[model samples]
Target: MHIHKLPDDVLHGILQHSCYFQYPDFYKWKRLLLLLSICKRWRHLAIPLVYNRVYLSYYDQSEDTSIVDDEPVETIKGAKTKTNLDLFVINNCASLARYADIRILFTSNAFKGLNQTIERMKSVLKTWSGIKTLSLTLVNDVYFVEHQVTAELYDAAQINQLTKELYNLIPGILNLRLKGSRLDRTNKHLYGKLAGYYNNQLKQLSSRHAIGLSDNIYFAQISKLDILLNSENGYKLSQMCTTSLVHLNIRGVPVNYRWASFKTNNDVEQIVFPHLKTFNISYLSSTPSVDRTGTELYNNGRLKIHFPVLTKLHLWSPLGHCELLASAIFPEKMDTFDVLGSSKTMQVLSNMRIPQVKKLYLNVASTTSNIRHATLQLINKILENSPGSKKNKLIIHEDSIQIDPAVIEWSQLTLLHIGAQINMDIALKVIAKLPNVDELTFYNFVAENIPEEAFALKNTSGCHNKLEALNSSITKLMLGHNELGHSKDAVITVIKYLSVRLESLSLFGAQVAFDTDMSEFVNDYSHIYPNLTNVTFRLLTAKVL
Candidate 1:
């Protein structure tokens, strides 16, 4: 059947599927144009899909006199040289009017014609009456303009002017993201002029700096705000809070009490964010003495701030600082806590009471053997406090040591992922503990630590007896690493020892002869596991039976 002849609904569905979740780029736009040229009906059906999101950029070569006179070509790379974004948008204004999201990127070379470019962009934006999202990026080096004639000075002015123009053009923008840019004093003044203009429209805003959200702009409707703050601007958060803010992500900012200072005992003064649900703070560098002082103040009630509705807290800081923050701000409602730092961070959690955390992820970066042992003890302490009703999920990665079975509540865990190296004895002990584990994944496995006593049972009846004692309920098992010298025997022994009926088995980096090892295993497969049905081998050079 001809594609155009299909029902209109079907054709629309096909077009939607073709560009679903695709990044709007030059190639994607060209592909859509090709489809539009297929037939009039296809064009009519695909118009909305193509114009839903638009990407426009300005690449000025006026500084390069050699290329100023070159004719603009329509080729992929040549398109930038052949046409200015302003002219391109003017020509395709009809299509752009249907766009809901627009991304504009200005190259460093484009500073010469920035005013004209901004005017053109404003003209195009004026046509999109229903635009909801706008992303503006200025690619240039950082510099403050102080009566300078450098190219960067002009570039900064151009960016500031562009943002001002956009503020007037799209007052109802819901989602705005600005990158590789900074908002100068002039831009902040312009933003102040539009304070209440976006108070009810903007829902999410992200920027590289906090200056973009000057004191003038009210975030009454903003729910999510992501910003990268340096030490100089980090204190701005004390004034940026809104009652409606739910999620705030601050990265590359130094930790200090100034961020959430209180002036009085009133709720408004004590709690800047009344309904914040999630708070993510990542420090750029660790200052132990400073952090210690901050934590001490917070614990002693000198630095008081409240997050009544906060449930999910993610923290990435120095080794000792993370635990201090965790202890100071013990959110009773927190159900998920993710900590990323050295083993010392986990060690401090051993003494804390975090009973509400059901999903814990500890990304440790410890090399010393003593810290690893401390980390193990911390894990055990956390598991002991977790509620039995909650199905816990644990993920340990990056330089983590072998998990001791005594620390885990096997029946309470639903998912366990280990992305570190562990020997066969430890692996067996882990399996024996996870009696109710639904899925298990191991990144690197080593059988070199098998005890001589266990190896001596190779031809004895007691071998299977010891293996059968493991009470694993794992339905999916993934084995990774190929360091096992007795690869064939280890596979046989593991399958024989764990009496649980596995539904799926995957071998990663497995080295075994297909004809000799696999054939023998297949012959006894039904006797060993009558319920086993699926098997997969990945990164394995040896063939499978």
Candidate 2:
């Protein structure tokens, strides 16, 4: 039936339904071809829709032949046996390559018909002019012989030439991921060429290159860059700039320049990212060649130099350099500052001018009882440093690590996280002052930690009722590493008001209850919060028990 013959309204509905999802297969094309075989009018309606999507795969295998009788022998060198798999894909999918996308992969037979295979891929890429996405993947290993004198060398030369040609064809590609170790040499040269053809609108570029001492691939064009490099040559590529780049993350160790260290000032040479909004950096420890201790050493490269528009900074560094880093990036007006590991640097870190920083995460462990002094210093510094009246968060490692309440002005601090142990009066007063306080987390809990007064107040004045009076936004809570003891009644009473507004609750424990009835409790609470998405209960029990 001709689509034009249908009523105009009916045709519009058909077109809308057809446009719902991008059909990336040749089913539409095959249907059109069948319609053409039927009659002229049907063919006209199907042809235009058929032209929308083209899918193609090319292989060298003959349709009639089976590998059961003749398996190509693996060779170190020679004519280079090729499998029939490559032939099958190519011959079958050749016509479909023009409409949707073109995907190419090497078969065991690729070596046997190297020249023909290269011609086929080049043809597929060229003929598919309408294609927007193209994928080239290396599935299996291809062996090459280092023959003293043979035609095999000539074939190897052809393969290299073909690889170079393919490299030049890839810059126009939108999403690209190149895997395998053998292709590194070809890829490095390819990356150098691609740096020139960078698209300003490029979305994702993930490249895993050899860990060496040189900066070869340019990340200046990629908006989202994920690089896994060998530790030895990791941080050497700091010069490239994509000023418009919004998110930046580097994962690798620093290549120390020790001999020239003190003699020259190691400040960042140029600011590459002025529009950067979020930044995360961590060292890759799994690379076999890297010395764990060596990578931890302080280097000028550890400091973040290119951040003015940054709003969130998530950093994981050891205890020592935390303060030094905070001082270096003091100019950034961050909304969130998260530091991981023992926060020995808190005293120095909190002193830096971070008036714009509202959420400060001191996610760290302390061995000494001196935590109170350090916490006080950090709070005092934060109050003195920040310019204005913005509420903030101060998450101490645990509640037992006593902090002087007077050092921090609870009036301006909206959120608090600490160890489970708390003085009932102090806790209530602190909760009262932060009217906007929304989220609270208690780490390392114990049942004995809850005072008798809290239980009595829950029954009498309903302290849980006062908690209910707090702003509705105060809906999420995390109690990590649970230590619930004998008092289930008291615990349940305290949680009543909080659970009413709570959207999420996470519990981690060795033994939550002697009764093993927590699952029943969780299922009952699941229906209470209308907006609740998840409730997690993680029990840590010994295998023997």
| Per-model TM values vs. the true structure | 0.69, 0.54
User: In terms of TM-score, how similar is model 2 to the real structure?
Assistant: 0.54
Task: Write model 2 residue lDDT over 1-545, tens digit each, in one string.
Answer: 86557865576456446533443443343434444344565445544444444433333343213223444422222222232223324435433332223322333433334334445445445443333344333322233212212432323354446545544543345544434343334334333333324334345544455322233344445566544444333334433345545765655533231111111234433233566777765533232343333222234445344466778777655432352354245344678776654445566566556636767655544423565446655565655566453656666664556544544454555566776455334444445555555556555433444444344433433222332333424444554434344466644534443343333333222333433334544444434443323544333333211
RMSD of 2: 10.0
Model 2: per-residue Cα lDDT at residue 543:
20
- What are the lDDT scores of the predictions, listed in order? 0.53, 0.44
Evaluate residue 141 in candidate 2 and report its C-alpha lDDT on the 0 to 100 scale. Answer: 26
lDDT of 1 at 315: 76
Minimal lDDT window, size 10, model 2:
255-264
lDDT of 1: 0.53
Cα RMSD (angstroms) for every candidate in the order listed: 7.1, 10.0
